[model samples]
Target: MIRTILLLAASAVAAIFSGCRSAESTASIPAVRPFDAERYLGTWYEIARLPHSFERDMTKVTAVYTARKDGGIDVLNAGWRNGEYRTARGRARFRGDSTVGELEVSFFGPFYGQYRIIALAPDYSSAIVTSSTCDYLWILARESTLPLETFRQYKEQAAKLGFNVAALEYPNGRPE
Candidate 1:
């Protein structure tokens, strides 16, 4: 009887520990803030990003946005792969408050998903971007290269957002 009781107790303890870990992980995620859509509408070069499946092995990434005739923004994304240029086009619309930097970007047919600007510079020259669910993330720059100090600051911000900043892949053209 004692052995059975001890086993049950151990199981309970393990379960409790697992629950605590899960809660802690979830709580570590940073809160999303409102972003200004208009001020964010422009071309941005990808400076760094967490390793993602779609963008793996891609370099020289750039995203461009222009006002659309139907009150949406036309999105054009391009990158260099294997010495060739690859591109994709999409559309984005402000989610709720246009002043807040949040929008839904769609590339495959009509399906859309959240694109939130989590951090940005005062001149809008650089920004740290993420999706609503925190699955996608990217660091954007107005120029092709990012200064070391600025990159470090952005990495720190991304770490606070529950991202593994160590996983970021910086572009190869610039020296670290």
Candidate 2:
């Protein structure tokens, strides 16, 4: 009876702690319905994102997408690094049809990572992209600047999907 009691107590404790970490999760993350890939194709300015090593100190970043002849997407990521313009070219392919909003993108050759369109404006003015893992998140806008109200709305959307918006890094290194 004592062993059973201890096991039950341990399980309860584990569940409590896990719940404290986050309420957002992959199972709860949502993607836009019927995402229009054609309108989504073009230049997007990075307003904020979760920082990663590959893009360290990158400012004035932009992601330009163009459809390739092979029915895949060609990605061009450009930024100002150490006062010099730097760019990385990659490719993206949809997991299903363009409307599904599921895709994979890669900066390095062959290897790819998940890229899901979680939230998008009807006019294609702004978008929020994240991985299925919900660990990687990006807030992109058609212009370098975003309206205050719109930014807040996007933040709420990302938070609802389980992203830690408080940790988002503005590429210019200043809190807005």
Candidate 3:
């Protein structure tokens, strides 16, 4: 009887831990395949994003990625807020396949967040990225501004993917 009870407790503990891990995983989101990480390296401007506490009232946001010696990617995200530029440096590494746009990024040590690219332009000019949850989404462009029509198209794509498009805010205030 004692052995059976111990086995049940162990199973329960394993189930609980697995659930917690999945909560922080982006397995539900399908990342873009055939992605070229080499071409994706460089600066990308933030066009639009769903509201988040860390990026509140920020404008002219941008992200820069570079190849790291350890085969990881170095990340630098910056935004203009309160009349000054605020920046956060992070690191990202591929979760599995390098050709797939699924990465785990960490700004805080040992606590990684999902960085999944759901859409991307063939020429690497624009992209739509999301996180483990539906709450995090971003539209990025090579230039600071994208054509108005292109922006709308990207918004529609996000909407189709079940993102809350209506809640997205333009960091530079809607492309002109």
Judge candidate 2 against the unseen true structure and give its global Cα lDDT, from 0 to 1.
Answer: 0.72
What stretches of model 2 exceed 4 Å from their correct place? 1-27, 172-176
Best candidate according to lDDT: 3
List model 1 lDDT by residue over 1-176, tens digit each.
00111222343355467863221232234324545556777888888865655666788788888988787898888887789887877778877766767677777555565566777888788888765433456788888888889988888878777777766776545425
Better of 1 and 3 by TM-score: 3
- Give candidate 1 regions above 4 Å deviation: 1-36, 173-175
Worst 10 residues of 3 by lDDT: 1-10
All candidates in order of lDDT, best leading? 3, 2, 1
Q: What would the per-residue lDDT of candidate 3 be over residues 1-176, giving only the tens digit for each residue?
A: 10111222343355467865312333566999998999999999989988766677888888999999888998888888889977777788998999999887776656566688998999999999877666678899999998788888999988877788899889888764
TM-scores, one per candidate: 0.77, 0.81, 0.84
Q: Who wins the TM-score comparison?
A: 3
Native-referenced Cα lDDT, model 3: 0.78
171: Cα error in model 2, Å = 1.6
Error of 3 at 160 (Å): 1.1
What is candidate 2's lDDT per residue for 1-176, written digit by digit as tens? 00111222343355467864222335456567788777889999888887666667788888888998887888888888788987777788887777877777766645565677888888999988876455567888999888878889889888876788888878744335
Question: RMSD, model 1, all Cα superposed?
Answer: 12.5
